[model samples]
Target: MQTSPQAIFFDVNETLLDLQPVKESVAAALGGSKELVPLWFTTLLQYSLVSTVGGRYADFGSIATAALQMVARQQGMEFSEAAAKAAVKPVRSLPPHPEVPAALERLNAAGFLLYTLTNSAADALEDQMTHSGLKGYFAGRLSVDGVQKFKPHRDVYTWAAEQVGADPKDCLLVAAHGWDVAGAGWAGMQTAFIARPGQVTYPLADAPDHTFPDLDRLADALTMR
Candidate 1:
């Protein structure tokens, strides 16, 4: 991101918190196979985009539940709501990625207001951060549920800026997801993409001003003052 952003918005799920446990849980629940996990996640994101473009609204957890069930049916696997909840239970108690804390501290110390913006349900987000001992780092958190639109939609990024009391231009979005960065960049916010292993940016999207393999490096690059 550019120097001195007035506020920084973070994408929560795989960006700050680790989701491997949830993936593992889902994989185990689905006949001890891991292949369906990726498909389910990808489908979840696609369905989220569908809801956003269709102008329909659903909480993230609800959408996730439905998506899981749909995937299970397609795979001819039995997945009850109870089972699905069990599989996804790890989300509430996920640990932060190893590089996250120090990076956040650097940004906080550099005098940037920090906030979380995620597709997760608002209440679930609070629980996730509190459970992971990361609740205090951010000044605030917002959710797609609030606007009934998902990230990569210009409305979400611009609305997030308004919530943080800054123009989109003065806000920088930090995320591991290419689509999130692309959306924020298109919304006129500076964006930095954290290239977590196994993740890639949308190739057709605008190039981010900064790309780091991890948060610690990103912190060093942007907040070295």
Candidate 2:
């Protein structure tokens, strides 16, 4: 098993910030039903991967808007650029999941260097973390924007490790998304899969070094304090 990681890189969005509000906003703007949120989000991820694999670059916010338009048209819903922006604006202001603060505190107290490596742009991630009251617990934050690519792309993980002076094998990625765990595993980083409700690890990927239902349990397992 992979061990002795020198740094921990966290995935933001669903892993930390509660996306329920964003989902509700999406629902209100579209079908007036929250179920559309998952479909829209899945479309967003698909296109993000497409853009990266095709060697095109666009900030995530722009991509989110485009994805919204595509989904709206597919659903025959009215979607203006302004309306799309309004629907997703809540993303910048989401609250951290209930267990996040104390668990991060536990990890920090135990002397692990914690950082966030997100698909968001740097300024956007700053706003989200600051608004969520999670900014101070991390030593730093890295974004795929800096690498001009999205997660599941090997370079993004390698670039994040380089930014912090850690080898891929010496870093651990903690995320709730199966795609993320699979990507990090392929990139040679140890991983902790947070199988939050409705989330599951990728069956085809190598298993995570640790798995937990929530951050609190992960803290209990990893924290020295």
lDDT of all predictions, in order shown? 0.87, 0.90
RMSD of each: 1.2, 1.2
Best by lDDT: 2
The stretch of ten residues in a row with the least summed lDDT in candidate 2 is 216-225
Residue 20 CA displacement from its true place in model 1, Å = 0.9
lDDT of 1 by residue, 1-225 (tens): 555788889999999999988998888877777989998898889999999888898888877777888888998877688788778778878899998998888878887788999999988998999988888889998888788898889999988998888999899899999888989998999998999888888888889878989889878877765
Flag regions of model 1 displaced more than 4 Å. Answer: none
Evaluate candidate 1 by giving its C-alpha RMSD to the native, one decimal: 1.2
Deviation from native of the Cα of residue 93 in model 2, angstroms: 0.6
For residues 10-126, write the lDDT of model 2, one tens digit per residue: 999999989888888888888786777888899889999999999998888878888888889988776689999888888899999999999999999889999999998788999
**What TM-score does model 1 achieve against the real structure?**
0.96
